[model samples]
Target chain A: MKLQINNINKSFAGSNNGQSAVEALKNVNLTVAEGEFVCLVGPSGCGKSTLLNIIAGLTAASSGQIDCSGRLGFMFQEPTLFPWLKVKDNIGFGLKILKRSKEKINEVVDYFLELTHLSNFKEAYPHELSGGMKQRVALARTLALKPDILLMDEPFAALDAQTREMLYKELQEIWQFSKKTVIFVTHNVREAVVLGDRVLVFTARPGQIKKEFKINLPRPRDINDIEVTKISNAINQELKTEVAEAVKELEHYEK
Target chain B: MKNKLIRLAKPLTFIACLILLWQILYWLKIWPKWLFPSPADVWLTLVKGFANHTFIWGILISLKRIFIGFGVSIIIGTLLGFLIAKIKLLRETVDPIILGLQTLPSICWLPLALLWFGLNEKAIIFVVLMGTVLSLTISVKGAVLNIPPILINAGKMLGADGLNLYRYILIPAILPSYLTGLKHGWSFAWRSLMSGEMLFISVGLGQLLMFGRELNDMAQVMAVMLVIIVIGVIFDQLIFGKIEKNLRAKWGL
Candidate 1:
């Protein structure tokens, strides 16, 4: 295993002076092999993103152990590009922080900008870019660091359908080339099936692994392919009950 | 170019009309020449002061006090603000006091400053410092607090920690807000410096205004007041305004 998580759990204390705690995750265990792509899919409030955060060491797990062999990278749903920095500088931010020499930083930045096809917009700021372009810049920024494990939280969720489809093809190509182990979180079942080597379906709040499906589909799977739809439907069937349960939980809390 | 010229015409016409009105009022002899001098009289006084070098020397003296006082306030205010912002306990205890001090007018400190420094350069600079420091400190604290947490997290994820975190992320993130604070602080410092000079000092524009009053020279008083306004507008447009415009463009604000 390139990464191993054992018995992870997380809970948040209620804001109103010692009310009941919100259990976000419970007794989750998983492993990812080198260069494997795993997608986590679940209903709203299902702790999918929370688990990704825990793995990135962004949010601490309330209890559990995680073992990973190399440096990590994270891509958020929003681009999170620095508004003040130009596209090239935003891509090179991590390398600059690591105190890389100017020449090395420039070399890496140029390579990634070329990879992301953002050479034309290298001088543009985040606000000037479209949503897809901004996300591409963010992707370039993360990939420039070349972390062994990449954790992404709904990285394409905010984009339009056409833009998202194009990025999916591009991302698939990039992942095929880089072969980094990836743990991706998303709510879209079709996205999970198209992207993941294995898909882990999570239950509603206090999320646990409800089921796991191995995607035996071949490389460069189209999101619209019949095989992808079949897998997505299977996952969505599991998710439908979880969504209903989450709604019931909300109403129960209200009462 | 034509649009720009047309934009400039409105204000110029309004000013010309006001000046003509003032000259007409003077011609009516509604009050003694010592009480309400015409615009030409004020202009003549200004020209005479320039010829004698009193006007230039007075401006230089006032500017020296402003620079020194403003410089010290910026340094101390930034340090104090960062300290209070980072340390929760310090912020909790000191923030209210800073808020209270910000509300207090700069002139309110004039008496205390005069008592402490004895009506000299020290007293005037002290007043200027007091005028601006609280506002700068409060603004800096607010800027630091308002920085989006995601930026900080992104910095940390990029492997920046401790001092590097502040240098790379926090400082740049807060720069736009800090510039706004500097502009406000400068205006406060300018006002405080003028008020402080009016009572104690004898070598500044403020003192020149007082001297004209003592001699009942309304033209000279109006001349000095005009000089003060011109200086304020020039610095605001040339210095703070330019910096703010560039920063906003760079930040895509």
Candidate 2:
């Protein structure tokens, strides 16, 4: 299946107190095929989350067309687990809502718990888990739906650095095994290069995709690899310039 | 064991000093033995009331009123809160009204309740309702609002919408706060019911207080006061405290 987002534009009405419509996304375009992992990197307030929200159908784009064939699963910045539910129940939440059979729901939940390595924590609540484990549970909850496309918006941004690195590696392993299409949004250049099959760099406010780099690095690529370093450095340089220009434009408008 | 004793040291010392002071005043002839009763005198009064079988009946009536009124508040409060949190227009209109109600003392509703329902169980139920409903509603609204926006998005992405969205996601996410609200509301309801009994003076711990007042019997007043304090503390420590502790431990929040 192919997911195509064409000429997507999103604007917030009266966001600047009637100065003008605040354009969050500007003519954004992207395409993903089955089993592809795409990472979107951008500066703060650069509409990376807006794009993800648009793709997930959480928010409507001012003008755009999104073509997708199957269900979309979302993983947010926070774990977003229901505090009142046990881990297994949270994972099987979507299935339960879809009215799947009790036995089938249990089976799928068990499979996802194993997939996310949260089988032992099946009865634990979200508050009982550490940050990384919570995110993993969130991942399991999404995977339980067997969504066609997984949209993640900085899902590990709140974890400690060591935990974040470990999760990134685990995510790569999960992706390799499942071969699911994923669109992950982040501002971390290294994270993008480490996990993405292709990295799309976004500019600051009124965000638009400035460049796309196909990561030719082999599987099990390390963040410290020479190729990874080259891409990260280049992206870092581009981001600095883009942010500087975006700030100048913003200041000019404010005056 | 040593650390546990240390934790009890402060309150234990305070109680010991209070008892010592009371004993001194009693021995010093502060008032006639019949008028200003010693601690032992009040203890005897408590046993006397118990032997007469009036205190237990008063306690039962008070408990019944509290349970009924508190039960109503929990139902109405939770539903009202859910509605206010989910519907923007309702929130805009009803939230301030709830806040206004919360500010007024539970006793302030007594006259109005009597006017509407007269001097009966309805008045007591109305008092309990006034005391607890706002407490539950506020907590529910606050809990619902505090739910991270991402959870809602995740729910919708997982095919939750309309009523299913609320039942599966919003309700569970807000439960801790809702439960916390109930704990708070129960205490308020219990207090209000006792106060209502005091005003009605029919059959309750509150009426026992009125009975002591009518006869100029300070020992009886002291006994009734002790019963009220003991029941309140025991109920909170036994029931609400246990529930709150279990929830926090199991949920790790």
Q: Given candidate 1, what's the lDDT at residue A164?
A: 93
Q: List, residue by residue over B1-253, the lDDT tens digit for candidate 2.
A: 9998999899999998998899899999978977778898898899999999989998898888898899888889889987898789988898999999899999889999999998888988999899999989999989998888877887888889999988888887776677777778878998888788888847888999999989989999999999999898887877777777887776677
Q: Give the lowest summed-lDDT range of ten residues in model 2 chain B.
A: B172-181
Once fitted onto the true fold, the runs of candidate 1 whose alpha carbons sit more than 4 angstroms away are: B1-7
| DockQ, prediction 1 | 0.69
Model 2 misplaced stretches (Cα beyond 4 Å)? A99-106, A249-255, B1-17
- When summed lDDT is taken over every stretch of 10 residues in candidate 2 chain A, the lowest stretch is A13-22
**In TM-score terms, which candidate is top?**
1
Please give, for residues A101-176, the per-residue lDDT of candidate 1 as tens digits.
Answer: 9999999999999998999998998989999999999999999999999889999999999999999899999999
DockQ of each: 0.69, 0.65
> Could you tell me which residue pairs clash in candidate 1?
none
Across B135-222, the per-residue lDDT of candidate 1 in tens digits comes to 9998899899998887788777777789988888889899999998999999999999898888776599889999998998999999
> What is the CAPRI rating of model 2's predicted complex?
medium
lDDT of 2 by residue, A77-161 (tens): 9888877789999999999999999999999999988877889999888887999999999998999888888899999899999
